[model samples]
Target chain A: MISSIFPSKNFFCLNKLSVCSDSFHLNTSLFYNEYSVILTFLFIATILSVIIILFSYILAVQNPETEKLSTYECGFEPYEDARHTFDVKFYLVAILFIVFDIETMFLIPWTNVLGQLDLVGFWSMIDFMFELSIGYVYIYCIGALDIH
Target chain B: MIVLIICIVLKILVVVVPLLISVAYFTIAERKIMGIIQRRKGPNVIGFLGLLQPLADGLKLFVKETIFPSNSNIIIFLIAPMLTFILSLIGWAVLPLSKQIVLSDLNIGVLYLFATSSLSVYGIIMAGWSSNSKYPFLGALRSAAQMISYEVSIGFIIINVCICAGSFNLSFIVLAQNNVWFVVPLLPMFFIFCVSMLAETNRHPFDLPEAEAELVSGYNVEYSAMTFALFFLGEYANMLLMSAFVSILFLGGWLPLVNLFPFNYLPGSLWFSLKLVLGVIFFIVTRATLPRYRYDQLMYIGWKSFLPLSLGYLLLSVGILISFNWLPT
Candidate 1:
């Protein structure tokens, strides 16, 4: 049943239990600690966070007020819907972040394999860095990152 | 099967319970320390030295009626704080308490932490939009953009650390520091990471999100009762998590300072906690001392300053490593 839930190319071994094999194989290269540990942690965290919220939710008394329920605008009624309150600057910030962020993402895998990549890999990444830096310099010159 | 399930659950509980407890105490500590800086008594009325203040605060928040805005989108509003709290806690699965004490010794530990921290923005966006309020929406925009901007530089900072340590695995990063902590060599990068960390966590000097004078408590302006408590908990938890990252990446996490008699006499986990406290103190002191950066200046520093600086440092460090044939495996 466990094997069907998280099928792996190799045995999915927890700390000691090998759910995918006949016997526990501690030495199996297929240590699923990394793979499933996050799933377990996320699962537990979700349950725990929800439980903490619910413990309060269940214990709290419900008091309803129309005035309290209205959106807060410091004693006055909201002049405009918050959703309609848009800033064009934020969109630019978001766009610029996504562009450079993806560029930086490429560095992660490169760093992991840097030793095997040798000097050729070194210069190539440096070249890429210069290219990105030029683009960043251009972005800065144009005041793309600035907001009032 | 039953035994395995029980064991997994137990291990998770061990990590999560202490984390939650420390987050509670972390709030109390911040208040107490901040009060001392300002020459006031901070929350000493509860249990001895207000150690139980967080619990009391939790109980008080829990008992109050939750006020949901009539104009708000109810569903996303509910999910937002839950998402923040969960994401904050989940990063710990990859953080090492000691050499063998990690919940997940994942090869991509750094990446996992990066992803979780980045994803935290969505919670704020969802909450602000759903609240249908003025300040929260504005606060959310500032915070979300601020976090996103700083995260780009933080990514480069991690690359700088990874180049020195030679693995995305956080444990390898820690163990690689046995001969010397990354701080001594990468002090500039370490300082940049700390500044970016402050912006990332929305703490003081960069806390435009909750610049109460302007934002009136920011993106969580509308949240009340337990939901607000979740955001509070999530913020502190993120602070704790970021501090742990600093310790692991730069301060020789879990490794004894000098590995000498007194420091080594204490356990590895204890050392890790001490470093975390150091980080927390740093956070509080910055909060007390530094004035909040204006929103525009905050953007200027994140992009124009830290971003360029970190990217250059990553390039230089990697270049140096390659030239010296010293890339760690």
Candidate 2:
């Protein structure tokens, strides 16, 4: 009863027929080909890495001079570990630079489109510039950009 | 589908290659700009007008050995700069240089950009943590805090623009400014956004994360050779992206300037590119002109000043929209 209902022979024959088809074989090859692109990229990347390493080894120098190996600071005797905490002013100045820098950055595109905008764009930019100038004044009053 | 793929490939190549080249020259531009500001010559011997200097620097970095510290997490150290570099590039996908030239015009393009920019902080964090060094770790922490804080104000500023334009689509936002750019009604918000972008990008003054006199090159202190180059590229790319955002949001993306003379015939993309270059020059100028900020002061500016100002601008825009019957009710 089980053998009559299962039809295992027919299933096996169908599987064999499907496997033997040229389209199925071609499909498998296509799958392999797609995988090979990624494989090729990885292979190329690895080769490049090896070549760079080998090249660097040829040019790499070894210097025992204590000064040469020390953390760089304009040839002045490098005082203190690089991790030693320094003035907060340096960070402040950097932040202020970015703020004003970005403000001016925004003005450029507005200026480009200003002519087509007529009085509207012109006045708009004036207003924007005016507002930005306030921040500039504030920053200046605090002396954020002052390097000394 | 095939055409779309080709278009995408071409767009990526066009944007990425020129962007890489520009980033390289930006280093030279920065030096030259600084020199001019400080009254000295900068890097003149490498080539004509020091044009070949960036190439020489690239070669030097390429030849240099990448030293992975024994105590460092090698996998994360490798992945951090790549992450930052890739994220920096991702923002360009949405920016419309001309009417038809954008890579992807997602409806929520602005939000998508903000999301991508936010993810970049993780790269900084990973770089600091994976290095197993104290300065980088501190730098990363400062960067993470600064970025997250300023992002809120930036988000609020963007919301003000959205309120005014009544769209999240970047192209739509630009089109909404057909008669006038939002820079007029949203001047205050635009101002806040600019400051926020500066802090967001960790540019000078806000560069506490990589303070040379303090953190010794910050998160990428452990990085060298091409690995370091990727981070440098990512930074300049981020600068470009921020500039692009300003162009798109407030300035009107790719919209021709008021049909003046020969300028009308010039493509919108050329205008956008010109704007971007001007933005780079502005970045350099600021670097020349300004000093860095104290950490606490940075926080104060973001939270105390810019945040409140942005919130006020957002409220003001909303009030105007509602009063003008622009709202759907």
Candidate 3:
């Protein structure tokens, strides 16, 4: 019964676990082999990027005047060098933005696998999050992220 | 095929979910650690010690206006973070947390990891170039240089591991260390690996690219809200990957210090998790303790210090193996 379910190849030995006896030979013969997966992803990414570029170009209205091309931050005339000495506040905000933003991305996958993980995964995540919160609070207290 | 699909799904479920949650909290952990180190109280508001802060922050970003600079190449700007985020996530596919638990237990797992990590630089460069901002561009350039520089040493270190273990498979590497962790025999290589990890992940003392005082927000300066968040996620995820790599490579991943009662019965994945958590704590501690290094200082440490040390260690390991008749005689 187990053999019927799992087939001839043993799960423990991954090299022999594939459906075909000569899996490597089959893999070599296939046009899109396992090795090509990364390349395929790269190719897809490139194609998507090109498509986005073309789409943006078609939609964008380019009035390429000097001032228009220049940096515009809340319509302030390019006052001070772009490399002007800015307060650490700007950086703090940027760091905070990055830090918390990453935390949110994790919630989705965690929620999905919560059932299988049981309390172990849950407590681990909580502990992990708690440590992260400490960093946030530290940064906040140090005025790392404070704009004021 | 059905079984294969089930295995693949299981791998994804195991790797991706934990990865995301870990990345999220890594940020919070960084902040909190930095807070404690500086002798200040970290986030205590927003749901009992700022427990709900990450959620609230995510919501705020989701609703925030995404501003595109007029001169920026908007498409690349948008895609760059996504690229970084995706690439970061892919490395976990090859990382074997335990005996039977990995997303894609490829034969060339180490090579796959190296390849993906190298590819991540493209995202950083694209983010910088597309922003059309000098700071972002400079940051991107710095990142490109730094990543390439350290990557060589990192690759060499991994090669040394491969030589010692005689396998490219991560699980095999972990299994090879069953008798003794690599940290004992390959102490120098282990040290180099740790430092290389710091450089590879662009953590403090080596984070020249994102040096706030100099490069502003680095490559993603123009990025706002969730887009910015993606880069953030990618960075933290990369950090987690590095930490996990360190744990598995040197710390005898999932191998308890002493096989006590519950520890003996505990799942291998649990041990892997414990090691990972400890690794994350180390990351936080480093961030808390170390100040950012100067750009030249960062480069000096990588090239002058880590590179030579790792190469020397590799030679030492080779010599030891040869002397012991451990080489395929």
| Among all candidates shown, the one with the greatest lDDT | 1
Give all candidates' CA lDDT scores.
0.86, 0.69, 0.66
Q: Tell me what TM-score chain B of candidate 3 gets against the true chain B.
A: 0.94
| Model 3: DockQ score | 0.04
DockQ of each model against the real complex?
0.47, 0.05, 0.04
Q: Could you give candidate 1's per-residue lDDT for residues B39-72 as a string of tens digits?
A: 9999998889888899998889989988778989
- Model 3 per-residue lDDT tens digits across residues B62-131: 5544556776787887788878887887777667777776545566677678778888989998988787
Interface RMSD of each: 3.0, 13.5, 14.5
- Where does candidate 1 stray beyond 4 Å? A1-31
lDDT of 1 at A129: 87
Scored by DockQ, the top model is 1
lDDT string for model 2 (A31-89, tens) is 34332332333343344344544465456552334543333344475444444464575
Task: Compare candidates 1 and 3 on DockQ and give the better one.
Answer: 1
Interface RMSD, model 2, angstroms? 13.5
